[model samples]
Target: MATMKDVAQLAGVSTATVSRALMNPEKVSSSTRKRVEDAVLEAGYSPNSLARNLRRMNLKPL
Candidate 1:
């Protein structure tokens, strides 16, 4: 499985950059976002949907 570190190394950027690109693409430059996106596609990376959903749920108050 490709981790964020793997994507970062493949994209020649930091892990923080990969995270930013995935979570908030607009925060990153277009070229950097493209590099990160290409690396993710080439690596067949899939974000953890379950974890993401859980985080969203946690953000909402009961």
Candidate 2:
């Protein structure tokens, strides 16, 4: 039962960095991307698509 926080902690970065690294790799550095990827594999992380879609659905257009 690994969480996003766990992945962030393992990667030595913030949760936002983990999200960016996962959702938008171009936004993160190569070294940070590698670290996040390694942490994801080590933590057996899996992004929850449904939750992400739901979150986007709830966002109001600016």
- Go through the candidates in order and give the C-alpha RMSD of each one to the true structure: 4.6, 4.4
lDDT of 2: 0.90
Q: RMSD (Cα, Å) of candidate 2?
A: 4.4
Q: State the TM-score for model 2.
A: 0.79
Tens digits of per-residue lDDT for model 2 on 1-62? 67788999999999999999988999999999999999999999887777668778996434
TM-score of 1: 0.75
Stretches off by above 4 angstroms in model 1 are 49-62
Tens-place lDDT digits, model 1, residues 2-25 = 778889999999999999999999
